[model samples]
Target: MTEGGRRTAEPLPTEMELLADLSRLYKIQPATALWRAVEIREVLKAGLPTGRGLDLGCGDGALTGMILRYAGERPELDGLDYDHGEVRVAERRGVYRRTFCSGSEDMPLEDSSVDFVFSNSVLEHLTHLDATIAECARIIRPGGNLIATVPAPAFQTLLKAQGRTGAAREAYVTTMNARLAHKNYLDAAGWAALLSKHGFAGCSATPYFNRAQVERWEKLSAMTAGVLQKLGATNALLYRMQRLTRSDDRSAGGLLETNRGIARWSRHWARIVAGGVLDNPGTDDRYGCLLVSARKP
Candidate 1:
């Protein structure tokens, strides 16, 4: 049985295998990559139909590669990202049939052309949320699905509930907003309504990365990155190490032997354990992240 208590028709990648794939991105941001891998695994477990799918805001294309690994085959996928450097790296990864450097607010594709589309942690960063979702609705054909994982509004709630008050709360909010660069945060109902307004139907959302798990990620990420910086190690150095050592599925073990690798491994293990307990199937309505889906109608 899967973590959700549902029988898997085919097993998802072993945690190690998923980590190995994420090692491609761990070089970029170790803590973020590891935690996002958790959310990606949960989203892919839904087993959506894949054909000529587009990965909107596909940073480094690593998450899309993880989806392909989960499906056990490629499915005529293409990726889009606004960062020129990230797009170049994604092309080098060669996971997608093509990679484009363009904002999600305006896709270059024709309307009613794609089978499905998905994004991971992308929509929250865009200021023009309506324009972007409209573009997503425009490109997908009738009956095609838009599956994305986004930061839910409960993140803000949990942040406020941290017992800070007065100037402390203000400072915390300011720091988090600056650090996260999120332009949009909404609950499931808000997302469903937005999608419905843009020609989608059957909008549904499931929560993941509950409050406790999110807190762990924040604490562990700060601790790990802080230690690495104090030791004069940078994400650049870790990326180089990963590039040199990551040839296949065994990369996680190889990295675990080093100090930086240990930091990453610690974060990964903490995430897995915390997620298993807090974000398991049939959790409460509040979540740090929302895995949402809608169909073009």
Candidate 2:
């Protein structure tokens, strides 16, 4: 239930840099920015193993692009995702040397061709963990690593603990889990044992986003998005305004860019203020997410 040891490869990004990176998400989806930006800090702290690597289950590739911006070293990066639409968006971002739209059970890569594999918050949705882990082990050279993040059991526990009973409680839990098609919610030890069965040893899981923060994210995301959508601003004026706030020249690549912006300046300001709360890196065993990594030996 412990947070993992601090990685010493390089100092983590400053609070200022975090806010700036977060600003990008804030403009896009003000409600979720707090949680997501904080997660980005964890990814930065973990620091990718240096060498050619694959970003398994890469979505729009935005997070991987952000990771590269801070990670002083550049590795040959390839990406794979089951969603072809997201694969197209990832390609436009230019974060991956190549992008493939393929299922996790079967990757379109030569066996033993990769140095490492990384994924962020993507494994829990898949039903075939064993097949996917085997595919990862098959493609990665011996001694390489598989690093990913998923909802810990505490995530579901926290959801259920929110005080409902009977069919109402079951419906709530089912609805939430259904959104992600979550097939697993294992603790670190459970994850370690699962990985060991598939030949991935030395597994470790570090918890992040304690209960208070998780609750905050859940509440704020629904509140903000719901309010905006009701007002019909999510896809109209708000969307246009968010586009204008972009500091970069690249075009916004996905449906989310047009569909998810929170137009109100108040939400943006609130996010900057919440940065402090989200960045605390609190110590709590009942965490919302777990960052898990294991070696294929």
- Per-model TM-score on C-alpha atoms: 0.77, 0.80
lDDT of 2: 0.73
lDDT of 2 by residue, 188-234 (tens): 98888888988888898878878767776666655655456556654
Tell how far residue 94 is off in model 2, in angstroms.
Answer: 1.6
Model 2 TM-score relative to the real fold: 0.80
Cα-based lDDT at residue 97, candidate 2: 92
Lowest-lDDT window of 10 residues in candidate 2? 1-10
Query: Candidate 1 — worst ten consecutive residues by lDDT sum?
Result: 244-253
Q: Tell me the lDDT of model 1 at 227.
A: 54
Tens digits of per-residue lDDT, candidate 1, 1-297, equal 443422345777644455555644454354565567668777766665557889899866766776766664446878899977567768877888888889888898889888899888889989889999999999998889998888887776656425789888877766565456777888889998999899899998888876665665566555655456558766566445544433332423445335576556644553343444333443455678888889998
Q: What's the distance in Å from true for residue 271, model 1?
A: 8.6
